[model samples]
Target chain A: MTEEIIIAGFGGQGVLSMGKILAYSGIMQDQEVAWMPSYGPEMRGGTANVTVILSDMRISSPILQEFDTAIILNQQSMDKFEKMLKPGGVLIYDPNGITRPPQRTDISIYQVEAVEEATRLKNAKTFNMIVLGAFLKVKPIVKLENVTKGLEKSLPQRHHHLIPMNKDALTRGMELVKQIR
Target chain B: MADYKLMKGNEAIAEAAIRCGCDAYFGYPITPQSEVLETLMARKPWDETGMIVLQAESEVAAINMVYGGAGCGKKVMTSSSSPGISLKQEGISYIAGAELPCLIVNVVRGGPGLGTIQPAQSDYFQSVKGGGHGDYRLIVLAPASVQEMYDFVNLGFELAFKYRNPALILSDGVIGQMMEKVQLGSYKPRLTNEEIVARYGSWATTGKTHDRPRNIITSLDLDPYRQEQFNLKLQKKYREIEEKEVRFEKIACDDAEYLLVAYGSASRICQKAVDLAREKGIKVGLLRPITLFPYPTKAIREMLGQVKGILAVEMSAGQMVEDVRLAVDGKVKVEHFGRMGGVIATPNEVVAALEEKIIKG
Candidate 1:
């Protein structure tokens, strides 16, 4: 099985890291994975995106024009990637700061109030984790055990204490997500 | 635990250099490839492996430092993007003239100037056709994946010292920035000074000894006839390399009616294009040149009768297409498809170009 995914949002919204964590999780499951990011000065304050592909076999291309899933965290990303999803694809997004929500009837859409949940938890950094949790709730591609292992691998040793908190955020995200279409 | 780790292509190059026992690295920071220098600094290979890593003030100084290290018969290297690489042309020429063994990595970005920080294969002409002055050719290896990025470091150094000529890893921003699983090789110990004397003492400037005259590392002969003789020797070496070192990969070409020629990042994308076209029942194949300097001319020649047309795909304004045309030699139709200034061509775009430019035309 192959899953081509794009995660996009503002630079500071942890868009790239979420994709990186997903990629590491794929690796934990012995899957072939590739992570390609929109890098450089574009990450300063502008919109940033990353493509993560997980496959059972060799991945053909890290760069792609469309995606099987688009995890969007901001309006800019929602407006840009909503139409790029394949028919019957999944789109998970946070409604915070979004002026226009996704308007595609062909793709399945889900909303996670990750910004509100992170604020309630008093951990702004866990916002992306919540969004990732929401994605897992809609489509359980990777196991939570693998994701925990992935988190341990990607996070530095000094920040190991945050794993439990991130796990909590993910759990809350799964609870908070609701299907819109 | 498995030996595999997820690493960016640039980071793989740095980690591989350390693992391969590279003696030293001298480089300046440049966009899309600055990670090479950053990774080396962070790893502190000097402490771990006694490998020296220095951030030179400028690209020119860095390349000259590479020249000096190579003259000492050390496995040395330097890396930069397009603009910084352009600054090193003169020193590269000097090293090529001196016939020193060293590795240079050009993680190319789009540019005739400081164009963009995005990835592009525009440097194909600059790499294979000799970016530096003179009639010198670098053994250019184009790595399409992160694994190849790691593997080519050892291979590049091997070929450089084997031929006593400079080698280059011609990469682009995509390969440098993208992350993938890579199984690293075993660690190798750095060569000692005594070992260098034993292996390269014939030509390396080790020092004057009673057993031999002082070895001079100079590209300048000053005498016209002597220079001509040296040039002929260089040409002969290049011809030998062309015969022995040409490397490429053929994908799904057994019954292909059309072929796509690409290398580095473009090749990875073309692989997908080949798959997409095949799904539609089009017999398309891909020829990925692993070694760009040798150009895989013979391989293209071999496919002349089988494939009806050839499409040269690059992330430039069609540089390698010239080489493809040369290989085809008017026997069949060959066209070019590309997106300049760092815009990558999609698989659908490539398929469309094949149909429009080759099948229809």
Candidate 2:
């Protein structure tokens, strides 16, 4: 199976790191993966996006014009990537700081209150992990055990103690997601 | 045993240099390739394996440092982006003229001047044809994936030393910034001083002894006749390299009626374009040149029998397309399509260009 995914949000919102974690998780499951980030001056404070592809076969074209999934965290991303999704693709987004929601009728849409939930949980950095958990809950493409292994590999050894907290946030995100039809 | 890890292309280049027992790296930080220097500094190979990694004052300084270290028979290297590479062109020419063995990496960005930090293949002519002022050629290796970015470090060094010529890894911003799974090689020990003297003692300036003549390293020849001889010798070496070291890859060519010629990141995109065209029952194939200087002329010429048309795809206006046209020699319909200033052409766009430029032409 192959999944072409685009994760987009503000630069400080862990968009790139979330893609990195997914790429690492794909490696844990012996899948071929490619992570291409939107870089350069635009990444200083502007909207940043990363294209992450996980496939059982060799991946071609890390740069793509279409995607099977679009994980949008901001309205700018939602406005841009909504039309780029496949007809029956999946779009998961957090309903925070978004003025306009996705308008596509063909694709499946889901929402996770990750930012508000992270604030309530008193850990602001686990927002991306929660979103990741919600995506997995909907697709179940990669195993939860592999994701844990991915976190262990991506996060530094000094931050190993924070895994349990992130895991909690992920679980909470999985519960907080609602299918918006 | 192969050790697997996830890493960016620039990070892979740094790690591979250390693993391959590179003696020194003298480079200044530049995007989107600064990670090569950052990762090397963080790893501190000087402490682990006695390798030296230094941030030079400028690109010129870094390339000259490579020249000096190579004169001593050390496996030295340096890396930079397009503009910085332009700054080192004079030194690169000198290195090529002196017949020094070294690896130079240019993770190219968009440019004529201080261009965008996004990826572009505009430096194709500058790399393979000669950006510097000389009739010299660098053994150019174009890597399409992060795995190739890791593997080509050792391969580049091997080729450089074999011919005593400067070798270049012509990467772009896309490969430099992208991350993927790569199987890394095992650690190799640096060559001991005795071993260096034993291997490169004939020409390397390791020190003159009572038993032998002093080895002098210089590209300068005041006499015009001697300079002409030297130029002829360099040309002969290049011809030998072309015959022995031309490397390329072919995909879906067995039943293809059309061909797409590309290299590096552009080639990776063309692989997907080939798939898309095949799905539409368009018999298209891809010819990705791994060694750009050798030009893969023979391979493209061979496609003239089966392929009816050839489309050259790059990130520039049209540089490699000239080489493709020359290879085909008007036997097949040839066309060019690209997006400049760091814009990457997508797979669907490439397919459309093929149909518009080659099929309908």
Fnat of candidates, each listed: 0.74, 0.89
> Which consecutive 10 residues in model 2 chain B have the weakest lDDT in total?
B193-202
Per-residue alpha-carbon lDDT of candidate 1 for residues B100-203, written as tens digits (9 for 90 to 100): 99999999998889999999999988888998889999999999999999999999999999899999999999999999989989899999877888766578
Collision count for each candidate, in order: 0, 0
- The 0-to-1 C-alpha lDDT of every candidate, in the order given, reads 0.93, 0.94
- Segments of candidate 1 deviating more than 4 angstroms: none
A145-171 per-residue lDDT for model 1 (tens digits): 999999998899999999999999889
Clash pairs, candidate 1, are none
lDDT of 2 at B10: 99
**What are the DockQ scores of the candidates, in order?**
0.77, 0.78
What global local distance difference test value does model 1 have? 0.93
